[model samples]
Target: MDEQSTRFETNAGVVAQIRQLPVGVVLASGPFNYPLNECYTTFIPALITGNTVIVRIPRNGAAPHFPTLELFKKHFPSGSISILSGSGREIMTPLMEDGRIDFLAFIGRSSSANALVKYHPAVHRLHTILQMDAKDCAIVLKDSDVEFAAAQCVTGAFSFNGQRCTALKMIWVHESIAPQFVQKVCEIVDAFKVGMPWEEGVQITPVCESGKPAELKDLLEDAIKHGAHILNAQGGRFSKSLASPTVIGPISQHAKLWTHEQFGPIMPITSFSDLSEPLDWLAQNHFGLQSAVFGYDPQELATVVDTMAFQVGRVNVNAPDKRGPDTLPFGGKKDSGMGVMNAKEAVREFTLETVIATTVNDPRNVKALQGLEGVSRVVKGTAGIKSE
Candidate 1:
């Protein structure tokens, strides 16, 4: 436990000492898209904060971690870190029902997250860090750079086959620039190199999740049935796991694609005559993770930022919605997710702040407490100590 303590006099005669302590046991579960990185984001923090961890290896990406079992055992005490395989319901249900887990770190669907939390015997006592579903949007204004916006949208919507929860699932362009924006997006997506991941310069590759290709096809077909068009040349071409990058546009509000997250290489586009259209859509939407707005006009961009600030966790101005640099806080709002996760926030999330205090007149007690290692003295009576 990296302990930092501060002593300060409160109300002239009383002294208070505060520090952080571990939150007991953490049960972490990551998603298939970023199995190792996502799991470690929680594991490293929980372990460093002196909590025992039990990892539920994702069904799709379980092979990669098998070799690292010895590495964890080598660094940590016996049973400090345990990796479990096989059925999630079989293993995780008993753990949650046992009421031993203090923190739940989950990066997956909201439904699964809800189910897992419900299984816990003490729901109120469980601290959850969830990264769930998102239908993130990108808005392009009339005054924006059409080419740049289109390129960013293509990258944001299709990167990792749009598997990321932060990926832009929908795009809205101003009516005046919709045609140009859609054309540019299609051209860029069509030019992408599609092949195996090991192939050189492959921008799109096979999806890992089973039935993902068919699921994307169903969404595309449903959108088409409801008056949407497949704008790209080779869009909607699916062969087993290899589904080509697709762009379906002028999508109807009634279309399933408007509400459901494809989680694949399908870009859904819409046009708006008034700015209120997108704003109102966002206000009514269930998921609010992030949104991207591209324009040159300061007032127009400011309006977007201000309106979306309340609706989503992040608002990207003239850029694609992404989670990177690992320093900034990342998570979602509404049904998208519950808690924030990052370098600093992760540590704070898995730990608890505790205080030890005594009267200043008790010199023996103060001396004994201050003598402890890792204690920092902050005099002149401040109530709280900022985390380092």
Candidate 2:
């Protein structure tokens, strides 16, 4: 923990937020996609900042009664963290209506987020953070390593059954290199193994959802009707609780795949003649969670990336997109989400700043202002003010 302080003089004395205090009680809701990660991203930091929490988690993602929950019980006093489970917003409704919940950190769909804001106008007062759906995209330049980029996109699109919020939902391949890149992507994705859960030879597993396969199929059919081509070997099946990875290519901009957030193993590939076209299309979309691009144009890429920096939360170059390390702040933009998350961001978001001040002939005579442990950087004036 770093000891941070600010020195300034006023009629009364010097003033600064000596400490970042915990905001208050939090109502944290976990997403069904990344349970372990989303949980820690919200609850842990709030707890660290001295705020109690009420967590409402989706049943499918919750790690049952294990260290995730048990460890919290073992260390913290009772009631510091409480877990509530129920379908949809059944459990969330009453909690949101409760006046005692001081804040909310949620990673879920926009419908739920809308409900939270609508039902609880005071939600903003809680300093809430909501992570909504994302229609993330990947751009492949003509000059890129086509095969390598294809492989990375395959993994980014189908890994985790494409349930990840930051998963590659669409690929905008350069028109000149589109055919070859699609061939490589098709070859790799075609060989991907899909089977029942816990199947040894299967590389792709079932979705966390039970009925999402039908939704994905409907979207796929719509894309095809709208001039999209299917690229996979077409050797897969979809059940009520499971769906095989589906790759559709040469999707038209008019297709639903271009607009909707398909949180399944349905990858849509589009071709663009100009690099800036896809980048601009992504910016125009409602979601701005994260994006990736593969290219060898060092100077152009840098300039493009600099422009993209403020448009999205994070940008991955030649690499697959991820939520990022616990140390680096991660969040969404526009309709995707607001506020930020990360151990460091969490500490800041969960705490409120209050100033401390005092007058002293020698600044060292007053105790140095202490800020959040790790994030603080302070200077000690033990010998008093230095001569200019």
Query: Could you say which candidate leads in lDDT?
Result: 1
Full-model lDDT, candidate 2: 0.78
lDDT for each residue of candidate 2 in 129-229, tens digit (9 for 90 to 100): 88888888888888899999999998899888888898999999989998898888888877887786678878777776667888888888888899877
> lDDT per model, in order?
0.86, 0.78
Q: Candidate 1's residue-wise lDDT over 126-184, tens digit each?
A: 99888889999999999999999999999999999889988899999999999999999
The list of candidate 1 runs beyond 4 A from truth reads 1-12, 367-388
Best by TM-score: 1
Question: What clash pairs does model 2 have?
Answer: 1-373
Per-candidate TM-scores read 0.93, 0.88
Q: What is the lDDT of residue 154 in candidate 1?
A: 95
Clashes of 1: 0
